[model samples]
Target: MNNQIKLSKEKREDMIALIKAYFLKERDEELGDLASGFFLDFITENLAADFYNQGVWDAYTYMNVKIEDLLEIQKY
Candidate 1:
């Protein structure tokens, strides 16, 4: 099973820019394109799954609540 998170080219560029911005603003250091890209790739490869799983869990909980409400509307 491939767990790697594949982002679109536009999204990847956006993320790289965001990472560079964060470093410049927060760390007072400028990150080059290669460094920012490597950072983004590392995050995508290593940390994205945790975030994705959390989103899935949140969606599941929300759906369960909606399903319960749906059952309450049934005529019996």
Candidate 2:
């Protein structure tokens, strides 16, 4: 599996801003734009796949439950 994740310019900026805000609020430290960008890139490359898989699993579970509920209602 490819380890690289691509984000559009707007999305990249948004992520960087979020990272900066997180550090500022949670760590009480200022994170520079370049540092935040690097951090975002590193996380996306290393952990995005796992996050994506978890999201897919969550969606599948939700859909399965909804389908079961629909099926039960259909029997009424």
* Clash count, one per candidate: 0, 0
Q: lDDT of candidate 2?
A: 0.92
TM-score of each: 0.93, 0.75
Candidate 1 Cα lDDT to native:
0.93
Query: Which stretches in model 2 have alpha-carbon errors above 4 Å?
Result: 1-3, 73-76
| Model 2 lDDT tens row, 7-42 | 999999999999999999999999999999999988
Query: Looking at model 1, which ten-residue stretch has the lowest summed lDDT?
Result: 40-49
Instruction: Report lDDT per candidate.
Output: 0.93, 0.92
Query: Candidate 1 — which pairs collide?
Result: none
lDDT per residue, candidate 1, 1-76, as tens digits?
Answer: 8888888999989988999999999999999999999998888888889999999999999999999999998887
Which residue pairs in model 2 clash with each other?
Answer: none
